[model samples]
Target chain A: MMCGDEYRESLRRLKPEVYYLGEKIESVADHPAFIPHVNSVALTYDLARAPEFEELLTTKSHLTGEKINFFTHVHHSCHDLVRKVKSLRALGQQTGSCFARCVGHDALNAIYSVTYDLGKKNGTEYHQRLVNLLKEVQAKDLFLSGAMTDPKGDRSLSPSQQKDPDQHVHIVARKQDGIVVRGAKAHITGAVNAHGHLVMPTTSLKEADQDFAVCCYVPIDTPGVIHIFGRQTNDDRKCSGCLIDQGNPEYGIVGGEALIVFEDVFVPWEHVFMCGEYDFAFDLVERFATAHRQNYGGCKTGLADVLTGATYALAEVQGTVGASHVRDKLVEMVHLAETLYCCSIACSCQGYALPAGNFMADPLLANVTKLNVTRHVYELARLAQDIAGGMLATMPSESDWKNTSVGKYVDKYLKGVADVPAETRMRLLRLIEGMTCGTALVESMHGAGSPQAQKIMLMRRANWEHKKRLAQKLSGTGESRHD
Target chain B: MPGQKRRVSLKYCGSCNPLIDLSRIGQVLPAAISQETDLLFVSAEETNIDTIIILCGCPRACGNKETIRARALRCIVVAGESVDAVPVAEKDISTAIIKKLKPK
Candidate 1:
């Protein structure tokens, strides 16, 4: 795997046509606004080489017999599945935010797991195509962003019924060499920095929606592709001359999201993984969603750990760390965060092997993990905010703290506990504010699909009929009515 | 001593979240150690050294320890509040490294 510096150089080499605030961004890796997010992405590479994290971050490739970053690895067994969550948590805590690599990792496993079944059913070579791609990715130690989540125009309609045909990415034309696709993928995490994309259908499709069921892999900087960076709150602060105002300056608060439009991008035959596999679209979506849901346990809880640390740090600076209420809040924050961690581990441990020999996390438990992540992450953030006090909201900007005229006043009055500098307090509070505010909460709510999506999946997988039978048997009325 | 030579490879992780500056090891110990023992930079792809010294920026020890082969492995983790080394030092790192390299 590339080190952090090499990863940066690799990103700089990309010729992606990216835009930020209506202006063209020539080099995403060099842009100030994108640097923090790039740094977040870069950590995934560096940590893989890091001695302490190597066990969890690097694994032996099954196809190539070479060492590869865990992000590019297929789950070989249940232990690999458990290690996935552990590594995500470690990276999450280190970055104190979404590292952005997990999305691609999750999507890779989903595609790798489902293609074998698809091949068995249809006599397709999709599984071998994916295996070849996996070998290449492992050899290069590259990042492949999982591109799903289309910009569906109407909530009630399917892909085929949409007024704007391009709302969901589709195979628009069939070429002699391969096929051409045109459409967009929205809220894609780490797309700007990825080496390529593993594009999949975002929704279940009918026979009429066969064109939209196309799944393929494409390089990020290919001709006819355009990326528009999505704005995050306080992003400008990261690009600001003053650094502390943007908390977690070393890493970003959430995955840097972008909207990528594929303008009739051409794909050769070797890279066209799945073409018009409409019936398997649901399987792909379910596998991807469940794997992604399990990740909430791994990454979100890591973020919760950082928030807990920030809360405790603030309490220390304010000299209220010893207060029973402050201590209680810290315990509560840990409780919620750990509960999410438990969900992640439980799902992974319950994972089973698919036909492709790739392990898939338990669908029911994975959904449960994500559902808990939805509620507990906010509650943990709330407890952290409570422990941090009101200053997180009312604190003056870093500029005021360093300004010439009023600087002295801020230094004098804003000081908490004798030893902690006013600037230190402000720095901690800024970080606390950056994460707990609207951005993180929104991501936790909507990133891996919304809470409602999880509930729906859970409903489908609940096995209510079996449960009813068990209830009857326990109540000594089993089969009485049937007879 | 009859021309006994020892090669040591050094590696450093990017100081993303260093508790203390990790460059001090290179600054203070490299020159002295190079005089008594061979100091080298091993590519992640190569493993020719007799000893590996991982200079980590913090307790996280964020370096590729796996497959980075050597006869002996030692780490110096520069933590936020403390300096944790494999063999505790009582003086300048150069003198300590020299002592370690040239055993009596």
Candidate 2:
């Protein structure tokens, strides 16, 4: 398996067309804006080779029986599923940020089972095609960014009904050898640094919207593929030459997201997993959502571990560790984080095998895991900020701390407890600021689908009739008027 | 004369949020097993293990994968308060495991 350095070197070889801050990026591997994210993804590779993390991060490929990164392996059983959660948590603890590989990992597993079912019922060869793709992915140890969300010009209208047909990626031409697709996928995680993308339909499709029901793979440097990097909260801090102010500078907040515009990108038939199979769009979407949702509690808890430690350390530095309220807040943060983790573990353990023999996490519980993340993560950040006090927001920039004349006054005034360098408290506060502030907090809410998206899944999965029947029997109202 | 002691191997799942006390169970199992049967606990890496007990903190029992189960002749899974999918109080986990290891 490739180490972290090898992963970065691999990126250096590919010249993806990525633009950031209104300027065309020469190289994602060398750019400051993308390095932290690159570092995050690189850790996924490094961890796989580490003796300590080898078991958690590496697994045997189900198809080839060759040792492969866990991110690329299909879940053969509940063990694989549980290990997926654990690996994600392990990465989170190290990076305290999104590693940006799970998106494609989830996409691969979702398509693996969905295509198998589609092939069986429709007499298509999509399953074999996907297996070929999976084999190549494992062999190369490539990073794939899952591209599902479309630009979606109008929120009220479906893809076919939209004013602009290009808003959603749709098959424009179907040829004997390949097909041509047009439109854009927005907020694609790891798009700038990935080797390629596994593009799937963003939402369910009707017969009228069949053109929009497309799924395929596109190399990052493929002709007509363009990536525009999205901005993050305090993203400019990276370019500001201030280490302490950037907060987790080696691995910035959230997965590095970008908008990918597919300008009539052509795809070979071998790379196309689904096209015009509008009925399976919901299946693909749901399966992808389930796999992706199963991650939050695992990774976020790992992140929470970091945030909690930083908070506790800050408290000790500030001489507030002895405070009863401070300790209680810390306990509350752990409670929220662990509760989310329990949901992830429960869903993973309760996973069942899909028709193709690969396992999928329990949809209902997985959705619950993500929904809790939307709230609990926020509460954790809030408690962290509360205990951190107003200084978390008002801390001086790292530059001020370095100023020759003003540095002494700033450091002397900010010193909390005795013997500890004021820089320690400042560094901890900046870390909290980066984690709890704008971009990171929003990622918790909307990443891997929004709160409402999960609520919808929960509603559909909940057995209303069964629940109602129990209530009716308990209340001695089983003999209904209709019955 | 008593037959040779059964070499038992111990394994654990990644303890993310264990509902039961896994460390305490690990501490008490050796003493309990020696009394009921000729069963000796050993590391998972050891060969000739007659049985393997996987301690998962919750019902997930993540360590009960086929990979781990294949390491020994017999596998006993303890998930929180359940032994081999049977309910047992947390305090009685070691005893229940010992009963499973006993020869007929």
Candidate 3:
């Protein structure tokens, strides 16, 4: 358990190679642009320490009786999946943005189960190695950013066929002591501030992709690793003096993303969870995807709840709350938002225990939840924008309002229906603009794997043959269909 | 490269229509449109427009034929529908529609 301030202070000690706006970042914790996201992550630490949330946010380690942050704890039952979703929703409401810790949470659980099965079959010690690593993470209460996506230059070609082999993370060199990896992970959330990273392969691989099928952990400051911070919409506003333009000023749009470059980073044999285990890659990928997809149901719905509240408030301020059309629209938004929440719960309810004795969500339902999320979230955002009105897009910047000569004119004309000030309306509109139209939507669409990815999974997993057989049986075909 | 700027009024219908923001149009058009355009009305339409640039509301609505007709219309060098929302690999009926509506 750790306090928020302590967590923030801890990150300051590590010298991560971080670049932002084309220059190196020496202090990640204190930078204005990074501070909000850092603060969002720090809450995960703080919640674990709090007595009220202890059960939901912290779990006792099976290896050691020591209490560890729930993010690092492997799921022991369906209750754990439920608890994970509840914890994520609570954090989402608190931060109103991505905490950027769940990736590592899911990745660890994935490797935990897959490695256990792999070790049982191959007589390998990956499970024991992963448990040892988990114990360390629990003991130290460290933040682990899970890195998955690679640069993947050509979408049409496989990793082995790519013109630039380095485009996908792979084992560039191997030695008796350990293996060395060289490549970059793109859009890695909170990579710069994370204490360590758990790097996993992006997709299932073939024998040809053995070199690319690697999973390992490395400290953020591991030699030859560099992090370049990704730019977010209106991110420059974080450094600006005014808070009006910075929607959810306490927590920015999302946990800042970074390009994590691993250049010949060495991992000891003990730290390498999987090396050249191509078959186990899909297991790891599916487990991680299910857990992560379930997460979208919680976090995004929480954000949608906030956006709904904000939009409803905007309607009130504009004196449109009484309009039947507006009320219907708001109701529709709630319906869609709640449907997503139900999907999360549905997946959680359908979760089953892995061989490692931890519960994992059902893959089909999890992917369906994420796919529904892709469309409904956009609809929710559209409804919010509609309710907020055209003012959301046309609102003048805070600077315009702050200008001396025109400030009075802006104040006079931009004021809402009644008691609400012009500045307040403008700020609310800006907040809606930030969440509805910008990077937030992109995250909703692609964060847990885009809509098409989930559809592919759904199509494959669907029991179409059973349905066809049922129809044949009813049509006097001698019941030839098998379950 | 033609000096005569072709005026293509692009109006979007359905979900695609609402999503077409000025910034996206600004970002995507320069690479596709060599000639200057005028009065590109990117409005959300409940019904299809007769003009060349009628973006369908959803991918399902504009099947394979519609996509083909839009491509054929590319020859007009005057007005054309840029169906960016439709996935390129769709072999459904929209392709034929696109081909039939080719600019003569």
Candidate 2 lDDT, tens digit per residue, A1-483? 788899999998998888998999988989889999999999999878754456578888889999999889999899788888888887898899999999999999999999999999999999999999999999999999999999889889999999899999999999999999999999999999999999999998999999999999999999999999999999999988788899899999999999999998999999999999999999999999999999999999999999999999999999999999999999999999999999998999999999999999999999999999999999999999999999998888888889998999889989999899999999999999999999999999999999999999999999999998888888888856458
Ranking, TM-score, top scorer first: 2, 1, 3
lDDT of 1 by residue, A379-439 (tens): 9888888888888888888899889999899888879899889988888888888888988
* Residue B42's lDDT in candidate 2: 81
**lDDT rank, highest first?**
2, 1, 3
Superposed Cα deviation of residue A313, candidate 2 (Å):
0.6
lDDT (10s digit) by residue, model 3, range A1-483: 677888898898899999999889989999998998998998888877653345458778878988788888888877678768767766776677889999888989998999999898998888899999998888888889889989999999999999999999999888999999999999999899899999999988999999999999899998989999999988899999778888778888877899999988998899998899998888888889889998888888778877887888888888899999999999999899888878887899899999888889989999988998889989999999989988877777788899998888889888878788987778778778878877888888998788888988899889997987787878876554443
Predicted candidate 3 versus true structure: per-residue lDDT over B1-104, tens digit per residue: 24433333333221211112322443344334433242232222222323344443233332223532353223211112334442333222234233434345
User: Which candidate model has the greater lDDT, 1 or 2?
Assistant: 2
How well docked is model 2, in DockQ terms? 0.09
DockQ of each: 0.08, 0.09, 0.01
Model 2: lDDT of residue A123: 90
Model 3 alpha-carbon drift over 4 Å, by segment: A477-483, B1-104
- Please provide, for model 2 over B1-104, each residue's C-alpha lDDT reduced to its tens digit, 9 standing for 90 to 100: 36888889777765544678876887787667766557787878788888988888889776778988999999999998999999999999988888788876
RMSD of each: 5.4, 6.7, 23.2
Please write out the lDDT profile of model 1 over residues B2-104, one tens digit for every residue: 4545556556544433444455665665666656644444433444455565555566665535644333555433333333545444245445555655557
Q: Between prediction 1 and prediction 2, which has the larger TM-score?
A: 2
Reference interface contacts recovered per candidate: 0.00, 0.03, 0.00
